[model samples]
Target: MEYRNLGHSGLMISEVTYGNWLTHGELVDREQAVACVRAALDAGVTTFDTADVYAQGAAEELLGAALEGVRRSSLVIASKVCLPTGDGPNDRGLSRKHIMESCEASLRRLRTDYLDLYQAHRFDGTTPLEETLIAFDDLVRQGKVLYLGVSEWTAPQIASALTVIRELGLRSRIVSNQPQYNMLWRVIEPEVVPLCLREGIGQLAFQPLAQGVLTGKYLPGREAPDGSRGKAGGRAPTFIGRVLGRPLLERVQDLIPLAGECGMSAAQLAIAWVLRQPGVSSVVAGATRPEQVTENAAASGRTLDDAVLKRVDEVLGDLVDRDHGKTAQMMAVKPSWTSTTP
Candidate 1:
């Protein structure tokens, strides 16, 4: 797979990174999950992304087992925090206690000493940004996390956090931001991409296929794909729900002929389109089968020429519009210092 430097850092990550979000321990069984990870490695994918919140941390354990005997130094292993992992108040958010404890739990589950990158799963509106940044800095100073990142964070939130990190002179700074990006979903292009390109933060774009929406398998009037993520009321109904409508499906079908002209599948076309965008360091995708892994891997080094790219955009038409309000959703959580009383 093709590799790119993560932001201004010296670290090199695979352009087609394997991410297990709704797959392991939920959609796909443990066996399939392991097989998919192996497939990604066989296809030259050296970057693997997961989170403690995924399947309540079983995804990390499965990924760790899948890569048990591989060369650790050759891979970029990443996980995230700032999400609820338990019932208690201290069990979530980006507070110092939660970040520190969560990292330890993740390392144990992943069977690794140091993570190549650690990310915040989402913005925590309840916690002070300083507390979170300082905790991340401590993890780096202690040699537990090499590079820091945040997922689904807006440009303004990122800017504020970076300012605090700079003022504090923290050794750990965010090198990447993961966001939902695809040909049909252009939410991040307006502000997040520009800020990242200017500030040396690269985008690890998730959902290049729009949760299988851009694959054209989900037909306009046909029943939902049986085993696909587009299945009605699937495990990720909330996220995948955005692309299940007929209008978007029709637009996606229009790109199929273009994909045929390019000698690739619609999914590959979607992935290639995201890779062509500015500030995109990697395309984070999840796969249920080995062939799916290879298909995504094929888009790693492949580039669509200006003609194909322009035609693909034209097919998208007004669907390419960006949504400023669609930035990362801020989650609310109760802090350890606060208690609710009736």
Candidate 2:
């Protein structure tokens, strides 16, 4: 796998990293999880992404256990905070208490002394940005975390955190930001991508296939495939899932011939499209099976030419407009989304 710098930091992450989100602690059993991870490593995927709240941290533990025999220096492990962990109020947010406690718990679960990168799962309005930065700074000083990152953060939020870090002389640098980016979710482009490029913050793009919508496996008027993500995984949940229904599926079908003409699956074409962007340092690809891992890893080296990219832009115009509008509205109000449906 090709390696890219983790923003301005000295760390390098594999271009196609493995993620333990919906697949590890949800769909895939222990043996399958281990095999998928091993498959990734065999294909030279050295970066693995997880979070404290994913499957309530069971995903991290499974990943840690699976990496038992692999040399520590051979991989880059990243996890996130700011999502709820338990019933208590202190169990969530970017406050010092939660950040410190979550880091320790993640270390224990991952069986690693230090994290290559630790990210804020989302911004917390209740906590002072200074407190969060200082907590991350402390982890860097204590040798528990090597780099700091934020996920799903707006440009202003990330800028505020960076300002705090600089003013306080914090050792940890916000080197990366994780956001959903794919053929169907190009919302990050006009703002987030440009901001990261300007600030030298690398991007570890999530959902490079738009929660499996870009895979062309769900054609219009067809039943949702038995094992596909819409039928099996929980990444997008309700609101986004509803948005990804037939309209998006039809758009994906429109691109099937384009992928076929290029001698690739729609999934491979989708992944290749993300890696081709300028500011994207890596794309986080999650898998439930070893073969899927292999297929995604191979997508790293393939280049989506100018013509293909333009075609992708044309095909995704509706989705791009829709998500960008939603993101703008969300930033103007709340920076995060939560389930309101029972």
Candidate 3:
């Protein structure tokens, strides 16, 4: 597998990071989850991504158990905070109490003393930005987190955090930003990419295949290929539903021939496309089966030519979502249980 330094940081991570978001403790059983983790390791994937909120923290516990015998120094494990892990007011958000408690809880669940990278799962509009940044800095100081990152944060939010970091002269800086970036979702390209590039922060892009849409499995007027995430009883309908429109599916069908010309599967081509973007350090790929992990790992070192990329843009046409404002829209919504008075 190919490895790249996370932004300007010296730490290197595999090009394809194995992530257990909707799978693991929720969708897939423990045996299948462990098999997928083993498959990722066999394919030379050393980076693993999970969040504290995934499956109510069972994902992290499963991942930790799966990697029990592996050499810890050889792997880069990343986890996120900020999302509600419980109904309590302090059970979520990026406040000092939440961040500190969450980091400790995550370390316990992951069976690790420290996280290679700890990320804010989302921007906490209710919490003071300085409090959030300071808490992250304290984790680095306490050696509980080695690097800092943010997920689904807008460019302006990142800039403000950086400003506070500079003002406070914090030892830790954001080395990465995890965003849902793919051929279909280009929201980060317009603002987040440029800002991160300038600030020396890399992007750990998730949903590189648009949650399997770019895999060419969900055909137009079809039943989502039975076991796919787009299927009625499959995992993550809320996520996969965004790109399951008939017109979008029809447009995605056009990429099949392009993938054939590239001598890669539709999924591989889609993943390689995300890796081609500037400031992208890696693509976070989730899988329920071992073979899926192996297939995604193959896309790590592959590069697409200029013509193929141009053809992709033409085929996708205006179906892509490139609006930078979408990030703000996402941040505006909060879980019903989360208090607005925070």
Highest lDDT model number: 3
Q: For every model in order, what is the number of clashing pairs?
A: 0, 0, 0
lDDT of 3: 0.88
Q: Report lDDT (Cα) of residue 6, candidate 2.
A: 89
Residue-level lDDT of model 3, residues 1-342, one tens digit each, is 999999999999999999999897877889999999999999999999999999899999999999999999999999999999999999999999999988989999999999999999999989998899988988899898999999999999999999999998888899999998888778888899999999999999998987788888876765767656755343486666656677777778889989988888999999999999899999999997899999999998898989999999999877767878786454343222222121
Location of the lowest summed lDDT over 10 successive residues in candidate 2: 333-342
Provide the global lDDT of candidate 1 against the true structure. 0.86
lDDT of 2 by residue, 1-342 (tens): 789898877898899999988888888899999999999999999999999998998999999999999999988999999989998989999999999999999999999999999999998999999988988989999999888899988888887887888898876788999987766566677777788898999989988876676787766666667877657755534323443555566677888899988888888999999899879899999987899999999887887789998998798665554244344343243212111221
**Order of the predicted models by lDDT, top scorer first:** 3, 1, 2
Residue 130, model 3: lDDT of: 87
- In candidate 3, stretches whose alpha carbon ends up further than 4 angstroms from where it belongs are 232-235, 328-342
What TM-score, over all chains together, does every model reach? 0.94, 0.92, 0.95
- Candidate 1 C-alpha lDDT tens digits along 1-342: 789999888999999999998888778888888899999999999999999999899889999999999999998999999888999999989999999999999999999999999999898989999989988988999999999999999999999998998998887779999988788667778888888888899999998897887888877777767887756343575556555666667878899999998888998988988988888899999988889999989988777999998898787777664775667731222112111210
- Where in model 1 is the C-alpha error above 4 Å? 232-234, 330-342
